[model samples]
Target chain A: MNDHSTPILASQGTPCLLVDEERMERNIARLRDRLRAAEVAFRPHLKTAKSWEVSRLLMTTPQGPATVSTLREAEELAAHGVKDITYAVGISPDKLTRVQKLRAGGIALTILLDSVEQALAVAKASDPKDPIPVLIELDCDGHRSGVKPQDATLLAAIAQALAPRARLEGVLTHAGESYEARGSEALSAAAEQERAAAVMAAETLRAKGWPCPVVSVGSTPTAFSAQSYAGVTEVRAGVFVFFDLVQAGIGICTQDDIALSVLTTVIGHQREKGWTIVDAGWTALSCDRGTATQNVDQGYGLVCDLEGRPITNLIVTIVNQEHGIVAARQGTPRSDQEFPIGTRLRILPSHACATATQHDRYHVIGAGQSDVTAVWPRFTGW
Target chain B: MNDHSTPILASQGTPCLLVDEERMERNIARLRDRLRAAEVAFRPHLKTAKSWEVSRLLMTTPQGPATVSTLREAEELAAHGVKDITYAVGISPDKLTRVQKLRAGGIALTILLDSVEQALAVAKASDPKDPIPVLIELDCDGHRSGVKPQDATLLAAIAQALAPRARLEGVLTHAGESYEARGSEALSAAAEQERAAAVMAAETLRAKGWPCPVVSVGSTPTAFSAQSYAGVTEVRAGVFVFFDLVQAGIGICTQDDIALSVLTTVIGHQREKGWTIVDAGWTALSCDRGTATQNVDQGYGLVCDLEGRPITNLIVTIVNQEHGIVAARQGTPRSDQEFPIGTRLRILPSHACATATQHDRYHVIGAGQSDVTAVWPRFTGW
Candidate 1:
């Protein structure tokens, strides 16, 4: 009744996060099927989609193998019956207590460590209790973290220092540079780099008398590119659930794979200047300038109609706390490209993780208005 | 013992949101002091802090004036005994049901409208119900919404047509462009523009025989700059409760006025590259590219030590979902800059409102760490 009679448009709303439940299920099912075809164990990171509801949907088994950033996530998922968890952060000194508590909870906690200092902290903490099993993080192509795979002596030193007190489980590496890849070839090359790094680190740990059972390597882009897990024990990825503009830009997924989006209402229009303001600002769609530095900077996010097609040369130029100015990307502002007042639009998030943090709940929609499956509430507490 | 002996840090752990209760008290006192000095009615916007506890502090009386962005905020504040409320959004047809319900609940509700079509919609909706008082949002700057002051006749016509079914309350405006102010002069200019536009609009409305009562003009930056509210009846400002880096960058408030910050721990260090990665990423601090184009672009936010002094030439660059990399802004990499594992650091928010939406609760810290008052939860459903 409010002017937007489009068959695909939902009722006008602002500051709302929408999860196309059908698309989300398809995205998850596709990835799980792919990992099944590759015969690789998929331990999806809970950090991307923090919802237990989404996590429950993605998993096929009762004891879901998961990847986590904080002890909070591990504890939350662990409490929800998600066992076989990998706390995929370099364990800090202060968090030892929480880590110990998590370990004592009969949760299979696998903490990642890079240096001897952290190894000492975890080793001593585990000795008084039980062996805190840990995976030695190896530096891949991206020089973010990890003991360099070639630095096998340092790995042996760390393993020697902690092996008696803590269990040296395996080696893991993330092909983060694959996010920077433009196509499948670059993603494949990045995957190769990741595999080689983890394999080399595991071999070094094994030769040096450290048990390296798990060799984990995965990124969404690389999961498909190099599926032959030669030395890899498991593949971990989180973004495969809700593909973003970044994932689509990397050619890892299509636009249809982007299951989540921000549902916004067009507030007003500056017809002369060729800009329309929406109620969903950075508070709804996060200010992640993801893929902004890429060849084509998807400013803020990709603007789509209810049907979800990219409106090229259109950019969310400016954003206040609760207002986004959707304007022409660069040149002359066209007057014809105007959505009247109170029009509903959906914006594709640059990164699913950043955008998901903005809203507290997601409205799971089937196809149109009559197909609203349910309203799933997601918890966001640090 | 933790490597870093910062006992004052978060026990649940580092890299979370901290709310200084004392600072919050002082901030509220300052706003009250400012209102007393200016002799103007103050309506604190709940969109800034979004905390019921903070709202209770602001409410000197049960019938305190407040502005909210969502229906949830209005209903919550109403339940908390706040009577005079302004639903500060371009009202949509779908939310009119809630508005009617709110009006029926005996809470004084004022809505914002711009164009004639919207005015007509509101007029038609309030048929069985009494005419609702409406505030015409005046466009002081070409920032977001509202009609310009010069277009007063069109505004008068719209007011006249809707006056039969809706009460034209008065003129109201927000100088959102004040955030872009370089100094006090620019801020004052923006404030003057805001005041003048609303005053002119009020004059135009009054000249046409409308009994306009409230002439409201506000915005955090403008409220800081403008004085002598000759025609203005009330001022609304949020974000002053927790001043952020954007507020500091504009030369409005000092770093000390900032009451909220993200508590982050040094998780990993690339010592060779001189980069220290923190656990708080775009998810914690918000991804606002705040005022970056204007002279000084804060990459994510200003990185500060525990005491809140800027780490000169160091900025957080390339943020993923839950990872923020701190690197030297200018000089070559230095070894001393690389923090050891588990070093706790406070991160300044670019925009307090945007940053606040990331967290569910604020860990209220008192005079010091030993006096941890309590955790204040916020409402985030819409």
Candidate 2:
């Protein structure tokens, strides 16, 4: 299905998501190789790519399982023969029916639980004959959802609640705080903190006579920065497959490493203001200003040429629902002659996950080629 | 097809869009009645709703033409028998083929052009037997794309280039700056500026012996704030159909007038920080912080009860891709007990256009009723 040819802009519509297949493969290989070297299982998070084609490339095994943010993704991935899927988000009672359906379909879908209430709910809903597997979410850095590893009483209570109807499979944690890490030192510390927390939670359960086999920990930033994964059995990270500006700004990846971009056409120009209006806007690129807090703020995204090369300091300064205003950064010359009306440009997003969700499909282009090799469909919604 | 019933949260997925049909109808009726009283055509922009059902409700004449942001929308609306449609975004050369196809299908699709280059391109590609119709885009506020109203040379050149092949239908302008209006006085002035600019462009065309019949002027703020239409024929506004927090902050609509919201379920809580995490996040509510600069900054969105009544001072403060953090505004009681896990809440979005674009379908509930009356599908992408 992967066909390579010369770049053809007219065939693909403007403001569509384009993925550099070669760069994407390199990214996958980097992570896959790193995890293999570290003797850790790589469970790629499907929330970022959300494409069956991309998932197939990421999987080491034919029917390998992955982590998904929503039941919709789990159902879609499972239908495509992905077994042992993990619904990473804390399972709400209302979604249990869908979970039951997926589990009954011969898919070993693992649910995440942080509270005793959630554990009891899962236990009540699970079939005793076919007990459900669950991973206890531990909060390492307190950035988002998860229980604290030190809360033994709460952890033991949750594990006991799931005794017969459900199994406490292991412990998992995400160092979302790793996103705030400044440099290599901070990033490594955050990674170690995440690893330690998950291992601590697993050990806590094991000490209580629970068979906690899994110790999963990850975050794109921490996963790449971690020096060791001694006690961690597996690591999960999504955005690494298509690094964005936020990742670049954090010194994790370079702008050239970004595999995804929004292909846009220059519609008009605001000459005096030094703004080149493009068809790609917030709706196309997404309203993710993740780089705003970073050392360098790319208003919306970094502007690049048709060949996916960054156009020096030009960046999208403003965006409406359907219009993006590209301008040169301060001290950079406004190269109006370089980009006139009808010029097609690529914009590297600040957050790959947010930008990718805006489009229904990705136009895959091989490296050194322009023609779309494959059109990968991505499904959205809860 | 509208059915009414009891409020059942479990059947519908969490973080799904919920449209209050009665509120939407009232909003539509108010705008329609206003435009009718003023003796002007009401061509509602379908960019916000993007639903055939909503477009059907907005049209005064059944299967009537409407304004759209993309060719995809025009195709969808045209397929549903909406004949005279206008693709509001500036026409690109690559999209001209699709425009021709839509025109060939018996749909009078009007294109928007602001440059002589574009006019010449359209003219060159046009079928002499059936020329494409275009509206000269006029810059009223310089907030986005358009040729300045006083740029007579450019306007005349475009008209001359479009002569034998493509016909210049009229002139249109949007007062996007009206979004920055502080109060009634500022809003009216912005509206007047939009009216004068569009009329001036139309007059400029007529003076050059060009037949400029249509003079369109609008924006949600200007459409409601304008005192007179004078030389304008039709008004185009979309978000007015589902007023949002940004509209309310601009004093254009009240919170009660917001017809669209994200129905989310509470998944967990951070009691010490007074944060209630919900399933609705940027993917559900959108990453639009439009009201951040407004007088009242409604974080991500205003939180409401299941019946769509705003819970005083509660708002969504932070959001990840799939998790929204709802918190009480300063000085308001932390009421953690009020919103426990599994509790359903409705969140009013900052921008209806941005938020609605995230969902595939909207679960609609009639006013004063809890049960979803219908499920309306909305299409996105260009």
Query: Which 10 successive residues of model 1 chain A have the least lDDT summed?
Result: A1-10
- Model 2 stretches with alpha carbons more than 4 Å out: A1-7, A330-333, B1-10, B330-333
lDDT of model 2 at position A224: 95
How would you encode candidate 2's per-residue C-alpha lDDT over A1-382 as one tens digit per residue? 0123244753577989999999899999999999999999988998999989999998887587588999999999888999978889888888899999998999999999888888899999999998999999988998988888998888899999988899899998999989999999999999999998888888888899998999988899999999999989899999999999999999888888899999999888768888888999988999999988887888899998888889878899888989999998656787665465677889999899999999999999976647787899997787
Model 1 per-residue lDDT at A340: 70
Which candidate should be chosen as best, given DockQ against the real structure?
2
lDDT of 1 by residue, A1-382 (tens): 3343443346635668878887888888887888788787888877877888888887666578888877778877888987788988788877778877877888888898898988888888885458988888888976477888999788998898786889888998988888877776777788888998999889988887777999998888888688467777789888878888888877888877898888777776666567788887777777777777676667778787765566766767777666788876656355367677677777888888888888777777776532346777665665
State the fraction of real interface contacts model 2 keeps.
0.59
TM-score of each: 0.94, 0.97
The local distance difference test score of model 2 is: 0.89
